[model samples]
Target: MTRSTTDEAAVPPLPSPKERRRLREAKSLSEKEVAAAVGVTRATVRSWETGRASPRGRKRALYAKLIAPEPAVKPPAVKPSVVKPPAVTPEAGAAAVPEAAAAAVPEAPDLPVAPPVPEAPPAAPPADPPPAPAPAPNSDTRSGAEAPDERRVSPAEAFDELYARTAPGLVRQTYLLTGRRALARESVERAFELAWQRWPEVAVDRDPAGWVRAAAYEYAMSPWHRLRRTHRQPDAPPTEPGKRALFDALLDLPPAYRRTLLLYDGVGLDLPETAAETEASTPAAAGRLMTARAAVAERLPELADAAPAEQSALLHDRIGGLARAEHVPVPRPARAVRTGSENKARLWTRAAVAGVALLIAVTGLTLHTAPTHYEQPISPPERVGGVPPRGGPQKLTAQDLKLQKSLSEQLAHGPERLVPQLE
Candidate 1:
């Protein structure tokens, strides 16, 4: 009996749903039959074949079995004899094949497709709104207003004004204090230099001139100035015959008495002002002034030879000459009193002025002559049982009183006496 051959070429497996549908149609199996064989519902089988779903699990296994290849059947054993065909030439065999069949099949024409338009990226969400602008500064705000610069005057301008107003008086005062024209100039100049440096703070002072005067006095009294004055003493010795005599008498006074006398009398400062300037108490200043006055009294005999008008003229001349030598301008005289029917008023005014002038003159004279009183030898009172005499009535004979009065007058008018002695 002839054996049937089951080794047909295996068909290529379907790759997609469309190929699977074609394969199912070729199989001629109804959707219901395929579903029953694959152990799935008809709808499932239809979906699988229609590409809506894919077979899985038992259904996939069953479908795979249904399409599985049949096993090859063995043929009856045949004798090994074979017949050989004649060899064919390459050209003759190639020519026997149809030209259309030998030529390569053209690939299906590529379908033209428009390039996909790229949708612009969705507009970025708008950025957070910018932070609100800062509020404008108010005109009233402290930071908004311009700061004022502190006003100040130049030192030169200030110094010029000060010098113009004060230089003459200060130089004159300094000459009187030092009794040396050059030294006086130096003192006033130095005081002005110091004032220049402190003008901003000092210009507003109630008495700027007075401040300068005090400063000049302080400078004149300094130890350095004292040393300088001592070094310059020879050069400063009074040259004028009259002044030389006065200076000689003044040199006889003790240093303390001379200083007090000069400051209180020559400088013409009040007792309290003199004390304050000299760093002394009022009582001490008074004592010094009195001592200077007494010293002048003791020297009065020689001084009295000069006439009173001569004495006044000499003093005025010496002071004025010293001031000029020191480069100090003299002050202008005060306005003269007017003469009118108001004679009584003028008389009273004159009297008051005269009284004030007299008081000043007396104070100056007392201070000048105080040194003489201090230097007078005090005779020891007759002791009672060795106890010193208590404060008894000061013994004063007529002659002694007369001598004292004469001495006072001489001291008051003497050209030779520039300073008084201290007791």
Candidate 2:
């Protein structure tokens, strides 16, 4: 009992519930793994994390050590050893002195003759101070090794590394987001392309993977996908009944609830992180998580029998398995993605310039063709003066025609007839 108490005292108190979860995640450990390490059921671990329950005795100490390992104690500095000269009695001092030096000393009757000691050999230079202990590797340093050449990596190389590391898992996550494999692959590709385009911003971000993940999730969950002819029909459900049921249940959920579930349960993110990623309040995220889980359980009778914590673990495994079962096409290479992004940017820029030029030309043409001043429109033709209509020509009477003929004959008869006619 005394030893146990001493051990407990030596162990530091565990961090808050949230912090415990964070430390576990920071180490990339899942609750099941932690539970196994702590020798407890997974549910106990969950309860401990939620603060509904606490571990005691050996379990508490073990759990504390697992989640938050105590920092290594630094070794004490090596102090230089000081060599003190041995004290000598009077006789020893006289012996240490040479006979000649002792003889040269003046004899005094009252005070014993003082013996002169030869000057001590110059003290050996203090041994070189022990080389300072190599600076203890920082606890934060990866694998307790010096920082790697990654610091000198070029932007493209870094981007490629990020892509290769995350693209597969992202593709799977996207598959969960959208049931359609094709859309999932497309969304992941598009997300990486955007990341490549904005590499400068992404490279400096605290969580570059999260940045890409958010982009991918946003793309996968877009309501606009409903408008697409290809996406209008659902893809064939998974062949296995269990997978099919889980996939269908996930699809039935609201996008936000589904996302929260996936991030927290499936991706192993903390509640605050899930809420942040989903852009919901903590309570709201928790509520959604509960609702989503309950819905899944209701649909699948098998899960209904299990406790909530176990249910969550099952869901996580199922979702992961389902995602993996689908043959997600491998993501395009990072170099290819970067090249495509650059090409797209160039194309868009050219298109924008051309559009501006076209707009300018159109504006100029409109200016040239537009009337400078409003002109009164010409009026349609109308009769302004009142005039009587002329009657159609009437046929000349027969007698008038004969008189005309006789006049023409008399005129033909003589020039005198023509002169009379003129008068």
The candidate that wins on lDDT is 2
lDDT string, candidate 2, 1-423, tens digits: 699888767665876565576677778787789999989998888778766799988888889888875588999977765454445456544437555544444455655544344553433445565585665654454665647653557898899899989999998888887877788888988998899888887886658898789889999889999999988766888899888888899989999999998998899887877865775556789999999999999878978999988988888888888888977778778888889889998999999999999999999999999999999999899876788778897888999899988898774544444344554
Residue 407 miss distance in model 2 (angstroms): 22
Q: For each candidate in the order shown, give its overall lDDT on alpha carbons.
A: 0.57, 0.80
What is candidate 1's TM-score against the reference? 0.33
User: What is candidate 1's lDDT per residue for 165-271, written digit by digit as tens?
Assistant: 77777766665555655666666666666666566656665457766776776676555655664435624555666555455555566655655666665655566
Q: All candidates' TM-scores?
A: 0.33, 0.57
Candidate 1 achieves a global lDDT of 0.57
Candidate 2 residue pairs in backbone clash: none
Candidate 2 wrong stretches, greater than 4 Å: 1-151, 373-423
